[model samples]
Target: MEAELRDPIAAIGLDVEAVDLSVAGKRRMLRVAVDQDGGVTLDDVADATREVSRVLDESDVMGEQPYTLEVTSRGVDRPLTMPRHWRRNADRLVKITLVEGGEFSGRILTSTETTATLDVEGAEREVAHADVAKALVQIEFNRKRSLPEAEETEEDDA
Candidate 1:
């Protein structure tokens, strides 16, 4: 089912974050989560809902069951699992639990395939992906967005 939907979702510049199917009484519920590099907007969700509905209507994958389709962004609660996920969430605050039994909270400064450099407290620290058990983005309601180094340099020049 996911294989069938991947290409179409990718065509519209979104990654298929998750797909869930559940039965509730007579109708089945289908939830699709889509995300992109920047973030998924309301328009993106609407477009994805339309595209997913169109695909399901034309295909036999759902097997004639009445289902409600919901398309949405991969919410902040989703754990950072991939390098791309880490990259996409740069500059955000995150809580990391290590596989070896320790945890820390930091702001993501940069990310690569094997490691992420975080601003832990006031110092920069590099954490290997392999050592991480789970990492979730922390919600900040009143946090200031940090400017990039280049932007800070330009501001200093001015």
Candidate 2:
């Protein structure tokens, strides 16, 4: 049953993050969470849900029992474990926890197949691929300030 839903979804270029099957009363429900490049959209969720439903209907993977299916994206708080996921999110600040028990906060300057470079303390540091215990994207904000009066007045007078 799991393969029934996973195979078709993967074939369509959608990622299946998780799948859950539950029984409530006399009916069963299937929940699937999916994601893809640039994040998952409502349309993507809907399309996957529809496709899975169609496949299940045709294959009767669940037998004669009645069931429901729900498909959605993994939330923003999802852990960054895959290297590709990290590479795709380059240029964003990230909080990385090392295996030895310390944490580092920096911006991801670049990423390669087995390692990533982080701009820490104004210097680039190379972090081994296996040393990262956990990593998450850091939300950033921009601030604008007014120029000093001398500069402002000089520009105005000129």
Candidate 3:
């Protein structure tokens, strides 16, 4: 279902970040989370809702079952499973649990299809995608880019 949604959502300049379906009593719940580079808007949700509804209605995909459709955008609390997910999360602080049981927390500096370069303390650490078992963005509040830190980042940028 999510695969079916990717193209339509991308056609509208949005990415389908997640899709979840579940049963709630007599009806089914179809939750679709969409996002983009700057972020998603209410207008985006409305448009996506219309598009999704239109596509679903035109096909027998749901199989005549009545389901509630919800289109939304939100922060995800799941593993960084795809290269796009890692790319989208660049510059965010994250806690990673590797498949080999090593755990670490760092800021995502950058990513490629196969690896992510993270800023661990003042140093850079690169990890392969296959080694990551779980990765979640960490909440940050009142973050300060102090002068020295700012300069250091600028140097790294060079």
Best by lDDT: 1
Model 2 segments beyond 4 Å from truth?
1-3, 22-29, 59-67, 140-158
Superposed on all Cα atoms, model 2 deviates from the true structure by an RMSD in Å of 6.4
Question: Which of the two candidates, 2 or 3, achieves a greater TM-score against the reference?
Answer: 3
Clashes of each: 0, 0, 0
Name the weakest run of 10 consecutive residues (lDDT summed) in model 3. 74-83
Estimate, for each residue in 30-127, the C-alpha lDDT of model 1 and write its tens digit. Answer: 99999999998999999999999989999999997778898989999999998989999999999999999999999999999999999999999999
| Tens-digit lDDT string for candidate 2 (1-158) | 66777778887778777778899899888888787767777888888988888898898668898787788886556667777667767777889999888999988888887889989989998987688999888766773457899999999999
Residue pairs in clash, model 3: none
Count: clashes, candidate 1: 0
Q: What is the C-alpha lDDT of each candidate?
A: 0.94, 0.81, 0.88
Leading candidate by TM-score: 1
Task: Give the range of the ten consecutive residues with the poorest summed lDDT in model 1.
Answer: 63-72
* Candidate 3: stretches off by over 4 Å: 145-158
lDDT of 3 at 46: 95
